[model samples]
Target: MGAKAYFAVAAAAISLSIVAATPAIAAPRAAENYVAMGDSYDSGVGTRTYDSSSGDCRRSPVAYAPLWAKANSPASFTFIACSGARTPDVQKQADQLTSSVSLISLSVGGNDVGFASVLTSCQLGSDQSCFDKVAEAVNQARTTLPAKLDATYSKIKSKAPSAKVVVFNYPRLFDLGTCGLGGLSKAKRERLNQAADTLSGIISGRVSAAGFRFADLRDRFNGHGICSSAEWLNGLSWPINESYHPNTNGHSQGYLAAFKAAIG
Candidate 1:
């Protein structure tokens, strides 16, 4: 073939190949299929430390979901986490899934029996049965949460059959350090985390049985828990008007790790 003709043909072929690799019309639609749901922490309450934004909900833009979704670029997100969301409440609030969705993230079980009040026990210098209280709470949630999650997953799969479900295990509240006004004992705080771990262990099975991904942040946030030097999780006396929630960096740190580790 003539030199000019050969060069022209090679350029055309290269252009065609690039177009094929790029897919001119039907890309994967990475921006859709992401939904974030849950309670006050999910709503990003304390990240801003009392930012006047997000209206009454105080949803921080730097919250976990947003940060995670941003990290997993090209992936769009639908955040529905509020200040007060129980498992049943989220079941009601989560949007109807459409055709396109890659992931759905949610955290719940705080408002079911008034989580703040329950946590208050730990905060109130009531270390006598803190572990026992945590155990009981986990047991109760174990009995009930599976049912709700099963229902929620059923509805989710019905619409976005291929979508991956990710359930976040709430991280540790207090490291072995003083907390609340009473100054919690390290042993008591450790017991609390252990209880949380127990709760996570039970829920992890349920999450897996339901074909979802369970992100375990307990180990990651071990030393940096509520009373840790870094203080990933908050205590009652946080700088933010919001109480006992992860800080901005904390959310991003934990959420991003969970997102990276989670495959559902």
Candidate 2:
């Protein structure tokens, strides 16, 4: 072949090789039929942006579930989670699920063990009272919470058998650092964090046993707990209902990031 022809052939071959080396872009996936269910955490109580139509359910646009839906533009999004929801209440919420639900995210069991009450006691009562309250809550988490969670998970599975269920557990409320006066002491904070760990462990076990995905938030929220320099959780806010829950940043950065990772 002539030198020019030979050069042209080599260039063509190189072009072909480059094309072969490049990966094909995957087609975008179909929109999901998502259902958000559980308790205040799932409903975005701490964000303080609620849908009045939801009434006491307190579903918030800033919560992780809605945030995901808003960003992804899922085929359909249903928000049924309510404030103060226990495991049984979550089970009831699952009743709204159908076979069409392609995705589900849940955060529960905190209320089942009376965590709010425990936190209140820790805040308002004596040191011993705080210890006692945490211990009692931990006991319930280990003993009673497992079965209840199992039941709720089973119900979710039964309702939306094809859905990809992701169970999100709570974050450690405190960073075990010294805040000013009227703050929980390091000892009390340690016990509370331990209780959170116990609860996360129990929920993880149950989620695994039920063949669902478990999205642990403890690591994600590690440096952003209440006492941290950058806090993602509320600390005894004006509306007491917002206390001890993830703030807007927590929902967007912590919980939403974990949910996306879990689904991906």
Candidate 3:
């Protein structure tokens, strides 16, 4: 071949050699299988946007679980969490978890301890009544709630043995020092805050024992409780039942970040 032809052939051979040496770019990894199991907070009760197909569960598309799922694009996403779900309800949700599940996230024990009722009673009733309610809730949180949480956690582990479970704690609904907006008295708010702390401590400890990651939201919502200037939790709503649950902003800014960190 002539000089120019030989040069062209050599250049083509060099290009092919370089291409062979260069590693091919990898395709994005497939999303993990995620199942969300818990109560109203996990179900997104306070948010206006909801999955009506879920019926009474009120699983909202804007909920932290779905928000995480959407952002991460999980291969599979099952939102089995329900409103008013106690530990028993969580156990039932565990039935949906299978071996293929790779990720799990939830917030439980709130309803198990009658958190809503305590808040409502504290708001509408007298100080003594509020104190009594707080005492009862604290008792349940200490006594029955732990066992219930453990049982639920065990069931979860059994269902998805290899899954990375991320358990989220409920945020305190009161700013204590500032929480007098509704009928809840300052003293009652302080007691309720204590109740929340008691419940969260138990749940967080149990989460560790269960070999699951615990996402703490107590401090995350410090200045964003029901009493804050910019409350993340809804105080008293017209529907009434949705009171004190995290609002949409709470789910996005507060719970979503905690979940992503735990899962990652």
Residue range 145-168, candidate 3, lDDT tens digits:
888999999999999999999999
RMSD of each: 5.1, 3.3, 5.7
Q: Cα lDDT of all candidates, in order?
A: 0.71, 0.91, 0.86
lDDT of 1 by residue, 137-243 (tens): 76676677667667766666676777777888778777775555555778777776666676677668777877888888777777787767788766765443466
Instruction: Mark the regions of model 2 whose C-alpha exceeds 4 Å error after superposition.
Output: 1-30
Ranking by TM-score: 2, 3, 1
- Give a tens-digit lDDT track for model 2, residues 1-264: 999999999999999999999999642434689899989999999998999999998999999998988888888988899999998888888889999989999999999899999999999888899999999999999899999998999999999999999999999999877786677888888889999999999999999999999999999999999888899999888788988989999999999999989987
Residue 157, candidate 1: C-alpha displacement in angstroms: 2.4
* Cα deviation of 137, candidate 1, in Å: 1.7
Worst 10 residues of 2 by lDDT: 25-34
- 2 versus 3: better TM-score goes to: 2
Each prediction's TM-score versus the true structure: 0.77, 0.90, 0.87
Best of the candidates, lDDT: 2
lDDT of 1 at 17: 91
Candidate 1 regions with alpha-carbon error over 4 angstroms: 1-32, 49-56, 71-75, 129-132, 177-182, 238-241
